[model samples]
Target: MKPSLQLKLSQHLALTPQLQQSIRLLQLSTVELEHELERYLLDNPLLERAEDYALAANAPTTGDGEIAPRSDAPAEPSESASPDEESWLGEEAAYLRQPGSFDEDDDDYHDVQAASISLREHLLSQLGLMTLSGRDQVLVGCLIDALDDDGYLTQALDELAESMPAELDIAAEELQIALIHLQHLDPTGIGARGLQECLALQLQALAPDATRNLALEIVHKHLELLGNHDFQKLKRLTGCDDEALRAAHLLICSLNPRPGAQYSTADIRYIMPDVVVRKLRGQWTVNINSDAFPRLKINSLYAQILARQRGSGLAGQLQEARWLIRNVQQRFDTILRVAQAIVDRQRQFLDHGDVAMRPLVLREIAETLGLHESTISRVTTQKYMATPRGIFELKYFFGSHVSTEAGGACSATAIRALIKQLISAEEPTKPLSDSQISEVLGQQGIVVARRTIAKYREALNIPPVNLRKSI
Candidate 1:
């Protein structure tokens, strides 16, 4: 049969471009949002940054519709100023009034980070000072190049020598001699093949003594015992008493396993909080961070031009720009609302620290703010809140729950905090095991299993009971 056209009336959800943009903007972190805005500014002539606009000083609003103070705004003297603020202002004024305080000509002031030398460069510099023959220096340089960032010679000398050109006549023995020379460099553990050798080299660098010898023996043979905190076996094997073993342990702990790490450049990232929590008039309040909030507006010149001409080519761009501005504002508004809801529920945590944290989930905050769980998840994913306790991701407040004996629920975060507290106060000779920690929490009315305690302990980067024990 031939198909015939049929008229049907059906209703279905469709996301408009504006709605899509709003959702996208809502999920982005503060840094990511800034970058996205910069891209928009580059693409649209009508969209421009309103950094110098007078309204910018009062643009940031808190959850209560009150203007949040700008970080860069000048402070005005007032009778209500606290003593500390008054003193700080007075000191600032004195500093400004001092002679030669202003340097108008120094317009090129900038911070210059000191250039860091890599492990290879450091080794070469030491090699330059040595009086070794050219052949020996070249062989040593080749070995230095083979070392990893952690200062460990992971490749065997035989393998490395085999990899070299046969015309160079390099041998494993020559590489071994070169290794000896390289190990004698400034970083004592530079050419070590493994952790045992690294610690042994450092130990060998120390002055000869009974303690040093014992530590050297342990490092060379019983390193696994020391690592497992099997002090009894170590004492029996080394024939050392408590005092001597303790000293040796301390000495071994002081040695750097990764000598080249100091020269390795670290990637340091900074987090900008979306909202700040503060206690005002005996109540917790949430305020948007001014620096993290994007200040945007339509370019006055382009907007005026578009208004003067009907159906201008930039009309679509103007509409797009307005949509972006509104979506950005809505983004921050949603963030502020969600953050305030979180602070309200987690006020106990702020007042009493992590131990007072209650069980929270995305559904709770989503229902409280009349938003979907997905919206709450997007809002909390990369967003951060700055509180008196510390800067934490918004998602950090929401965790799985554990049942309590009193017919209530406790946050997994709180249980972890309790476990940490118990471990921190445990006797060194006998650190609290996972089972013991579980019992301690059970006694506190929060039921946690040993496996969960171990998981949280590992998450906190805490070692196991066997590894945590001391001499």
Candidate 2:
């Protein structure tokens, strides 16, 4: 109960700024690492990216520590440079000689479109073409903004009217009218409040026919039954023949459920493989992608100045530049080592397919590399490998083990691939159920549970037996 001063000795690890930067860089994805590098490039004047780090590194240096000029009349272009008869060395060398001499027709100089237009912006563009009063345009604009990414206006008419400024003097009735106008937008179902209304709007757009009428009725009354694939019950309730119901179901299924999703402004992220695996002389070799790496160098001029004057701004930046270069190199080195280990262990997967993927975990790679599990996890998180099949995340090779009858462990990924194959080969009229699939695997010496099969099936996005059944 009494507070007293006590002497205690404790041992703990403290992370330095450089160590923190290393950890952060190790975990960053390709896009994030690019942004981080750009930030450092902007903040530190002592840091600069090397156009050809390999060439600079190999180029002979004079005794005074300066890069010596080439004495040869001319040197051959790099293998990476594309050949061009019009240029002296090559297309790459020509561009490098004149930085602004980029050809518009070149793939690297492609004029990519700006970010995708949002659903609201698309609706507003259509509205701009219409000659409407200012008040009407404002009402429609508000309605368009209220609609969600799926093109459904989730808010109620009353709520929308209440949120508007009092000076506008808008009413729920006006909002309801605006909602109807929004439903007539280019997307066909932009202002629908719910799934039922969305389908109904699409039905209205179809030509007047018995199929459309039946489909409209089905959507209005028994969407739940249609979703359940209770064709018999739907036929009974709708009092339509089998052929007619089938036609109506087909028509309904053709409608877009999420019209606005196509116009989503969300940026499309591209994968940059950290390591590339290629087969050479009947052996798989893993190599780090030079393009994925950012070649960095310390500004020799600033570095020289900082050496004479220690404890200056330039000195701090110089140290940071060195740390950045070292950390980036270490990141790629770790990635290459991990990828090689994976390729070595799962060579069969590359040679054959996912069926040959062995059961592996992060611990295996961590222990093999003499690193911690957390470090391995960070390394593999966003790292990717390019192979003959396709690009795959480094983590894709690691999966939980499932025991086999032969006393061997199989990867869950391999099992999922097997299930996908079984479903694909199944008869349309009588699709294989989860239990049947499990039994099929059991016959192949792999004893998987029915639920596990079902889980794997769902993960592969394979439909249930009822939904997969043919008409």
Candidate 3:
């Protein structure tokens, strides 16, 4: 092997900070991006979103018919068109005057609300309310650290207990006490081991009675059977007939599926849509908030700092500045392309509703739009679009396919919607089983297997035959 400077070129994926930032920005949900923007407003002095931008951009357009209203522009272009467009100057000015109005309750778009209370805040408040020994408090804090994003205690009490080495030989009873305290947090079931325990804790917090007791039993003993739609086992074990089990199931159904989700930032106020969609003149269009996506420029302060280098020849500073600008531009392009693809593929979704949505895979969109699967995934990850139906994540449009009799495939999402429709209309007493649903679908010329129907049902959070049984 020759260990000389051969100068052979090779390619490898190097995760540069700029690339990382772009990737990170691509996946951020609308709420998440707003939080990041606020962070930047505090940390970076050079970046600013003010009335002057719209004014300056508009000043040139006023001189002539250069920015005439387009005949093709949708009626609510302000909601769909990029806010960066010259026509959006008025809208941008409106956006700046009243930032607080961005609150979900407020119809105004001008306000910039403060960050909402996070999960940690909710738990910490509960921790303070409890009267535990200082050592016990420390142990509880360790347990909280072991809690998962779903707000469940993911780790075993023993494992979490071990993390509190100082509290070695901790009694299970003491851990249970702390566990009970954790469940009382703002979002119920903050420290539950699993969904069953989480639902049980939430139910216990509700008004206590025989129905509640039945709900608890269903939650603990037959929650898995409940999920599988095993109504017979539930009936056998609870000594309840199908009708009685239906009533019991209703009690459990009333419980929150994700008990810890109340503390989620999604529930905290409203998310300002970066993109808006609306119907106009029988056509659907997507509009980006070019203004909402602030024009990211290097901080003038940082530029001044670099200018004052005084022969220091700081290659690092120069490199960092260039990198930041490139990253900002690249981020915009990535988002813009993704937004376009989303509109192109999901236009039917906008025009009609969920069932009208065609089966769309990430690979199909990625290939059509000339991007990698991972790149498409990154762009769609947490981003949301505001449409007539309501706000939905970018990923919502991408689901598995089910073929029709004509060989055209329907989205798994659409299949789920259809299944939901069927079940919703089914007889309460003789509720549609997986096979029955499949037959119904087959009759409608939708080629699907019972297993496939069940799979889609499961994905849609639909219970099986027994669980769905009524009188």
Candidate topping lDDT: 1
Instruction: Choose 1 or 2, whichever is better by TM-score.
Output: 1
Please tell me which predicted candidate would have the highest TM-score against the true structure: 1
Better of 2 and 3 by TM-score: 2
Residue lDDT tens for model 3, 1-471: 867765688899999787787777777765676687677656545444343332111111221111212233223334544433324333433443433332332234345544377676767777887888886776677677777667877777766556555637776667877776677666766687877877888888888777788778888787888887677777788887666577777877776767656555553355555555545434555655434544434445555765787565544544544454455445555756777677788777775678788888888878887889998888777666656566677788888787789878888777788899999998877888889889988888888899998888888887777767654
Clashes of each: 0, 0, 9
How well does each candidate superpose onto the true structure, as a TM-score? 0.88, 0.77, 0.56
TM-score of 1: 0.88
lDDT head-to-head 1 vs 3, winner: 1
At residue 321, candidate 1 shows an lDDT of 84
The true-versus-predicted C-alpha distance at residue 308 of model 2, in Å, is 6.5
**After superposition, candidate 1 runs with Cα above 4 Å error:** 1-8, 53-115
TM-score of 2: 0.77
- Candidate 1 residue pairs in clash (backbone atoms < 3 Å): none
